[model samples]
Target: MERLQGKPFPAGYNPEVEHVAFTREPLYFAHRLLIFYVVVKCAQLMGHGFLLLAGHRRYVTPTHNLTYWHRPCQQEEGSIKQPPLLFFHGISPGIWFYIPFLTRLGRGREIILLEVPHIVTQLSFEAPDRIETVQSLAEIFALHSISKCAVAGHSFGSIIAGWAATAFPQHVKQLVLIDPVCLLLCLPDVAVNFLYRSPPTNLFHRTLKDFIDPSSEITVSHALRRHFWWYQNICWLQDVSCPLVVALSSEDDIVPSTAIHYYVQRHYRMQEAVKHEKEDDAGEMTDQSNASGSGRLIYWRGIGHGQMLVSLKAQDRLIAAICKQAVESGLATRAEDIKNSGQKNLRRSRVTAA
Candidate 1:
């Protein structure tokens, strides 16, 4: 496992400012319609009428789940409070799965959990783009008078979080992507196309009664299409500008470990080149520099993909990273101070997890 500072590849790419055209194949329309039909049918069977109401709901007021912890004394002197954080969760049971990390990582600040609306609501995946997701989050941020905040996403959620960071660079102070599946390194072209059309048994339900809920089928369908799109359009990552931390599980079965390594090594090379350039200009040697500002890659040994959210030790590392990011971004005064605060909570959490 390795943890190091470096810059993300394709530097100077800010998704919010750049304009990129998204071209969908004509066949995709048919695929999208079929997914929409499944979603609508599921919602109907579940007896959710609100989801049936059309015209994309733009404004959302997210409930603020805040937890207070010890802040560094330096922060008490009226320094600008650090922006809050918003978390986008992966495809799983739901946001409930993230409660452990939320309580620990959210200490001394606010952490927002935004549910993928389509997962619960009978919404069509075709109607929304990454920009719309960002806007929807912006509405929630505005409700709390938060002009800027960090964003984190895990697995499937990482794609949305990355898009949000790309579309709203100024608004996102930092970005955390964990075990992202959209990198398209693990699966082949044939596999992605096949999965999109004919999903695996894990994704499909033989009977509506067998489903946990109507949204179950829709979530799986959406995942297939979303991942397929990612395989085609890989330019989004080039535009992310804020501080980034990518955590990869070596044993991940979904996203190829090679893809994660490629991403980390690319940034590592970029940072090294920059350091050399500095030395050449100064005509002297110097100590190493921290790459946390540009990007940081964390390789998790035992953890599998997004499992860090639920695991105790992995969550400890994640909280430390979040606190470290706060300091790096000037959101906090001292990395050690914030880290200590989170550590104390982590100790208490150990008892709960046991």
Candidate 2:
């Protein structure tokens, strides 16, 4: 915590994201009761059933490295072409809450859901390091025979989706980050909102604390306190090489959305300037980006953290962005060919490994 809390936002920091006297006092509220987890487990069963009906097959990687859900395209007509979508879930009650969101993305395209048990599924103290987790991603890619894919993640899941882009650049073509907590992590907003700062005592606050309180979930607490290295979690604009679709909520309490917008705008300017200089020097226009150079930056006017899962408009927007990136990458055109090529696609099973 002390290492993260430094003075005077580096040489140049976006004024919007400037740190605001961040302080810490862990476990302000106790974890939820065991009955709450029991309720969550029941909800997971419901979600599992819904997924089966939706044609999502479950698979576990070698040595149980990861548990994921894969849903192939049901409709292959028309000129629709895209690559598979690899997605990660953030801390929530269970997967069932997200089936509505995930099912929409599954329309006319293949989608894969990466599960994060530490966040929402169950109580566990184990949180893998970056190296081990990235290796697990490699295993996931090889198992599915995916040469390239578009990765979309929400909340803390964005951190892992980012890993695929940075660790295996050749494999990831586009990124769709929805209300990501990983960006601008150097700032104190995320730590304060998610961990340190306490909400006011009230009827709504009482309900809110049940979920966001660091000590409310043992696994989440451990992940935040024992693991969660910001250096490993933090992802900047320059770190990725793929076309990025960053969806920032208007009212995100965890991260500084306004600050991130300014920071990204600055980077966009830098990116355009660098491109222009290279073109001028080479005396040829090559891989020319937009002159305005504002990359696909979507700012949700009223959405808050994880609110897109419930809003129909937000879902459609996310689908369109994902499809656009997938088409641009042209990696999914080969998806059908790969499916026909007879790779060991996951077998449909009712009972999946947890």
Candidates in order have lDDT scores of: 0.57, 0.74
Candidate 2 segments whose C-alpha is farther than 4 A from its true place: 1-29, 203-208, 211-215, 283-294, 328-354
The residue pairs that clash in candidate 1, if any, are: 5-291, 16-166
lDDT of 2 by residue, 18-114 (tens): 4343223353335677787788889898899888888889887675467788887576665356777888888877667778887777676777888
TM-score of each: 0.60, 0.80
Put down candidate 1 lDDT per residue, 1-80, tens digits, no spaces: 12344644553765666222122422221123456557556644443232123111222333322211111112333333
TM-score: model 1 vs. ground truth: 0.60
lDDT of 1 at 41: 60
The Cα RMSD of model 2 versus the native structure comes to 9.9
